[model samples]
Target: MKKIIFSLLVLAASFSANAQVDRSTMPKAGPAPEINLSKPQSFELKNGLKVIVVENHKLPRVAYTLTLDNPPIQEGDKTGAATLSGALLGKGSTSISKDAYNEEVDFMGARINFGSQYAAASGLTQYSDRILELLADAAINPNFTEEEFNKEKALLIDNLKTNEKSVSAAASTASRALLYGKDHPKGEFETPAGLENVTLADAKAFYNKAFIPNNAYLVVVGDVDFKNIKKIVTSNFKDWKKGSALPAAFTTPKNVVSTEIDFIDMPNAVQSEVIVENLVSLKMSDPDYFPVLMANQILGGGGEGRLFLNLREDKGYTYGAYSSIGNDKYGMTSFSASASVRNMVTDSSVVAFLEEIDRIRETPVSEKDLKNAKAKYVGSFVRSLEQPATVARFALNIETENLPEDFYQNYLSKINAVTIADVQRVAKKYFLSDNSRIVIAGKGSEVLSNLENVSFKGKTIPVKFYDKEGNAVEKPKYEVALPEGVTKQTVLNNYLEAIGGKDKVAALESLLMVGEGSVQGTPLKLTMKKTNKEQFVQMIEVMGNVMSKQVLNGDTAVITAQGQTVTPTPEQLKDLKAESAIVAELNMLDDETIKLEKIEKVDGKNAYVLALNEKKKAFYDTESGLKIKEETTQEMQGQTFVQTVLFGDYKEVKGVQFPTKLSQSMGPQNIEFTFSEVKVNEGVTEADFK
Candidate 1:
């Protein structure tokens, strides 16, 4: 007890001595901390499969990664050959059935995945040998059965269809097509026709041709010993015969002569996607690498980036704006800044994006910005050290990309050394604002007119039209002059007549509908009811519970969600008044404020557009006169966004035409509701609205 008391007194005295020295002055950061990066021991098998082993005994776990480090191969007519080869590689080995292999891997609680260019497996350290053997068998002795091939092909086609209507997918396809050209393998996407052209034989041929060990790398990290892993790797992968050298013939993609606009029109688009991109040849080994990354970080790499601050925080144009700069060793890489913004501000958003890009190039970044960028990179690098996989990746990168042995160890110092001038220099060399493709995939009919006259630095940037497939086309005329005989009343009357008739629609005193739908893949049930008294109620249920409910009783509107009830805003009240009607178009016919705006194409079909009181726009197909789509501005959870509701699969419900499918896309997710049954003038009462 006396000794403990003396030790406590000494400790307190030591703290008092240090605390009395200085409390106000900023302490200097000590010298740079030494980095003890694990150096991987490596070897090679007879067939040239390079093996890199990194040992970390902290946990009883192991990870194995086998990468075929080869350049892009041209598949020509077989665009998805390599993709199929990778998909079918992990089905089974010659010695084991597919089910048995999967069962054993699962029984061992390990994960094994085979890709066209790589294979990976990770689990407990005790199962490392077996996992490695499984990987080898899957890679070297893969059995390409016809049934599995057909299944994979079918899945690919199904995914293609799912992505067909996705705006983000369209943007990706267009960007790749523009940057790499559709003919290049880097840009080429597998289509239904192209996938159909691929066969089991073709997939096998691609596997035999590209899955060679001459340019392969195997990385094993975690609780592993170099000697033991070396033995396991040698026995399994020794038979992976090499000699499949990559074809050297390739073409590098080049940027445009000058800054220009490339537009792809999606008539249903509510938000415009802007991508400011250019070709850049950047590698990790280059001296400019760190500077380029820092420059991007300052410009648009994160929430604090200039792009996000200007567009989202300052202008309220988008939810987020981000930039990415890729360093591809085998193919042309790109530097891009992108955002999806409101339709009304599409031109301003584009201008803001370009100005930000140009401003970063012209002016040097502030000291604060530079400091923040450095701090972020430093923090990220430190956090990455906590992961064994990161260590393995770094080691593999050192060998494959030909970096200095101490590159990762010196990463922080290099990032800290980048100056404002270095940032500006690399920005000028890589960003290429003056020679970039301002790719805008949007509803061009609404934005093009506003954008074509938009001037940057007092010079107007002209717009060029392109189809969704990246094929250049002429500009589409938005406003089609109607003949003198076709007046607003004529169009409205045509629509009313097309739907069952004026009297029949007028007889729709009430409606009650129950339907099933999906929201980002979660199943939801919806209930909607309306009465002739301009009152409506909507409820959304998930898993047999009401998730949200919107109600309009005469002039008052309220919405209840997540156990909270709130009155609708004035703008929401206005919008609800229109929706309260059994049919919005029916109410529009009586209102003089609404007018026939113009004739535009909806999915390539001529449609009559009606300006619905400046809050919404309605498109009715010209020949059929059926209301096909309606776009409206909505505010939810304090965010203002555009909601586009597509009406299709029309069927006569009693005396009126009713749409069976309703699709709504808000922000990024698309939700669809297909009604199995809808009844008009049935099961709707005033009590429901109350």
Candidate 2:
């Protein structure tokens, strides 16, 4: 009996193995089962509320969405008022406190969400039939209370602070600002200041003006009877009042005539963020919309896009980069790229980004590239419908954009019909290198000078500072006031002597200086090398590793661990030159005026704080008694670090004595460092740089 069972099992396994065959060689299978799509029914209530219902009995759940099209037509600074009002609505309602509403929703397994766009505001709720009445109550009778409004406002402000620290968020905001002028309704970006100005009065006024039933559309989808849904909506919204029709809020802006470069300086940045944008087709109905979308895909839309292939795979300047167009009532298109290259190669990287854009416009995409792009797009699109939310969103887009009912059904056909000529034409038309607005956010002094030397167009480019709202704000100009009894010449010459004697410092073969410090309680170490070239290695043992290198004779700047290297942008190059100048000035300081103050135990190690004072302060007499303090400390990584250096300590290294000892307390551990040998005037040679 056992032998017979074993033989039967082996036979079963063999049969199963043979059943799997090569799908490509097999006969074509029949089409999949047809989807039972819900047909949407529409009606208008007595109070002018437009209702749309799509009945789906596949599951015991329902989803409701309400939208209001009352964007601010007469704009002052009321940009995000509608959005804020929608957000505050869910905090509480007339009959229920916020806590009560939250608890009820949680117990019933339901969700409610609300938001606003430039021309519309929307709310969404999902729950079973048993809790449908509660959802209706929250929607129809929102409290819009003063306390709730203030609390929501504070939350919005806090969220803005968190977003400002993200590079991607900042880039997106900056790109939109350039696409639409700061004042334009379509382009208005949120800022901490704008959010702060929003009050209970603003929320109330906005709600009253925009949230009327007449100006809104309610969409419901789920396992509910059409008649019952209609009856429920009518009874709940009967008391709602009609409102005046709102005028369209967004207007298309004229395309910029020339390319402009904007810079946002993030001091002590290890990488430079770059974005290039310009106007493109705004209307989904525009003849160029499809072509432009397909063109961007071929250029820099994803992993296989032109930018990723050249910058990441070929030259290795960035970990990744991409570009796309924002298709809305107003069109704004842009190509953005980023790299954390050495401070020296910032210019080279910018050149490469520009070159890729130019190539896409000048050269028509190859047949293979076009085919691959279409295949990827179509495959991705088909896969997206696998999720119900995506399918619903696709259907909603057709309704919102006023697109043809057959749009999704014909999507693949449209993508397949795009020709090589279409790609080339759109690229040439939209990729305007001269008119592109270039924005660079990085350490300004380390990247700007070199950028200026490179001629883009016929003239030198000017760098402009932008506020969080994307407004061009003038930077505050101020002169540094020196302490009393300091002369300009004494400060300049004596500071140089402190680093090392002028000749000895100039003849030094190479210098390696390690710096450690704390930023917001996070310990950080910066390894700096000065030879024929310059480089900085930033290590935060707790956080990880980051490195940047710039070679004097080469145009390339490299960020090793990230696998990125490229020429610096024109702006980046300019900053690098300025940084070199400051370093050069410090190398010329005198010794006697600059001396180590004393050695003291800091964080369990012998550490020294060097002090430097200028011998003559006449030429540099913007201030007197100019002093620099340098603190040194040691770490367990077998590294001696200069922790906190005060440039204001005027006597140690003449005018700049960097702290040689320091420790930063983080959590339960303290990151400490101590510098071992302090040598000035060692002949730092060119070979050391490489």
Tell me, by TM-score, which candidate is best: 1
Listed in order, each prediction's TM-score against the native is 0.90, 0.63
C-alpha lDDT score of every prediction, in listed order: 0.87, 0.59
Residue 238 of model 1: what lDDT?
85
lDDT agreement of model 2 with the native:
0.59
Candidate 1 lDDT at 614 equals 64
Steric overlap count per candidate:
1, 106
Global CA lDDT of candidate 1, please?
Answer: 0.87
Query: Where does model 2 exceed 4 Å of error?
Result: 1-38, 69-75, 117-127, 130-132, 161-174, 194-196, 249-251, 330-343, 456-690
Candidate 1, residues 1-690: lDDT per residue as tens digits?
Answer: 999999999999999999888869877646555678888899988888889999899999999998988877888889998899899988988899999999999999999998999999999998889988998998899989999999999999988986776777788788888888887877787887789989999999998888899989999999998889888888888888876598856678899987888888887788888898999988888889999889999999899899999999888888999999999777679999999988889889888988998899999989889989988888888988999889989999999888999998888878888999999999899988788888888887878888897778777887888877788888877777776787667788888888889889888889888889987678999899988887989999998888999999988889999889999999779767777888766766668887888888887788888887666888889899998898878876555788889889988899788888888888887888998879998888778987
| TM-score quality measure for candidate 2 | 0.63
